[model samples]
Target: MKVLVTGANGLLATNIIAVLLQRDYSVIGLLRNEKSFALEPHENLILHKGDITKVDSYDALLPEIDCIIHAAALTGQDIIDYSVYQEVNATATENLYKSALEHNVKNFIYISTANCFGFGSLDDLGNEEKPIRFPFSNSLYAKSKLEGQEKLLRLAKDNPDTKLVTLNPTFMIGSYDTKPSSGRLVLSAYNKRVLFYPPGGKSFINVIDAAEAVVNSIELGVHCESYILCGENLSYKEFYQKVTKQLNQKSSYVKIPKFLLYGIGYIGNLLRFFKVKTDISLTNVQTLCINNFYSNKKAQEKLKLQQRSIDNGISDAIKWFKLN
Candidate 1:
């Protein structure tokens, strides 16, 4: 099968491309700039320079593409404009879906974040059926992705022939972090004497595991269905301890109180109001103070997704960081 993956330079997309090549599938990676290409050259892997937000950039290539893993997204809490998020996360998705249909692309796998679903406590984990919850609902990034998911689902209902699968992954950490996206979490506490973290917990997964699930979705995923690809649930304190243990470093873990985080977020809001770019808003801070946990039972049953130890993920990330 010939596959096209967007955000080719992103941590997840890079891993996905590696998996596809290992499975003997031909790949076309769509990236905005050729100079930013991170993957090594391969006989079956072809890199294309294009913009995902603009359909014409990749319209001509869609004819021969059998499956498209739309992994490109505008992510970050720093951006203050919802329109920017909508353009990349929502409008781009709609345009790509329409073009895929016109070109008869059979499988379209969208990569969305778990924040689109309501998070639960350790006792009751969030699932695919949950609605958008607080803090995340206020997040422009999550709201935009949710908007794209809804549009794709609605479009899929009328076009039954094309299989549309959405994979919602939680905090992913592993290798190929050229931009060092999620790896920042690990880097933030690396070799530190004291580690300060929010009081909340989250569902974490290895990027390789998440990438495997994305490839598996092409063959095993059901149409118009969504899966939450998650792994072990750990609080901030527990996670930092794991990081310390993996790095073989001694560190004291301190949990930031919710009030303090909120206060910081208020300051961030003021900065944004004054046209400054910052990621410390109340929404992002509130997200850090809650148990944003999720379940992978659906993905396990449907896509045969496997859950790996987050320790391995941390180790890989640390090793990669050390080298790169």
Candidate 2:
């Protein structure tokens, strides 16, 4: 079967493409930029230059595919405008689904964010059935993603022939991150740049394991269902400790107060108002304040999903980062 993967140049998409090739499936990678070192040369792998936001660019590629893995999205970066988030994450997804419907695609797999279900603590874990706390999301990226999820689920309910499955993965770790998008935390720690750690915790999984969950969903996944693919939950301090121990670094990270972080965020907003480039945005600080814990029980039972230790994930990520 031929599977078309959008955002083929991204971290998760690169990993997913590798797994698809291993499963003996013909793969077409829909990437906006030119293929980088992230992609390996393979006989079965075909790279198509297309933009997910522009539906007209990829309309021809839809008919030649048996399945569509819509992994493309705007994530892990500070957004200056809300419209960009809506265009890339929400509106683009709706357009792709419309084309998939018109082309009679068999299976449609969407990779969504676990944060859609909102913040979760140790006591209250986010799950598939839980409703999203939309008001809590300060970032346009999260809001747009939630919008995309709702629209896609509605499409799944309306269309019976085309099977639509959404996989909401938690914070991802592991390799092949040329942009170093999801693996930014690990990269920062390894480089001794992570001095202050946030107090909030999050559920995390290895990227390879996350990829397997997506591949398994191709066959074992039930139609019109949303699966949360998560792994062990750990706080920012705890995660930093693991990285320090694994890398054998003597430096320790200090727990920065949330209030101070918010202050920095407010400063970032001021800089933005003046048209200055800033890394630390208010949305970034807001996200770091939330304890985004989630449960993977449903996926474990149904998709046979299994997550390895966080140590293994971190170690692998460090190795890949050092090499590339």
lDDT of 1 by residue, 43-96 (tens): 999999989987888999999999999999998779999999999999999999
Output the lDDT of residue 259, model 2: 92
Please give, for residues 161-230, the per-residue lDDT of candidate 2 as tens digits.
8899999998888888888786788767765744788868879898888999999999988888889999
- Which candidate achieves the best lDDT against the true structure? 1
State TM-scores per candidate.
0.99, 0.94
Q: Which candidate ranks first by TM-score, i.e. highest?
A: 1
Candidate 1 matches the true fold with a TM-score of 0.99
**Could you tell me the lDDT of residue 150 within candidate 2?**
85
When summed lDDT is taken over every stretch of 10 residues in candidate 2, the lowest stretch is 131-140
Model 2 quality (TM-score): 0.94
Compute the lDDT for candidate 1. Answer: 0.93
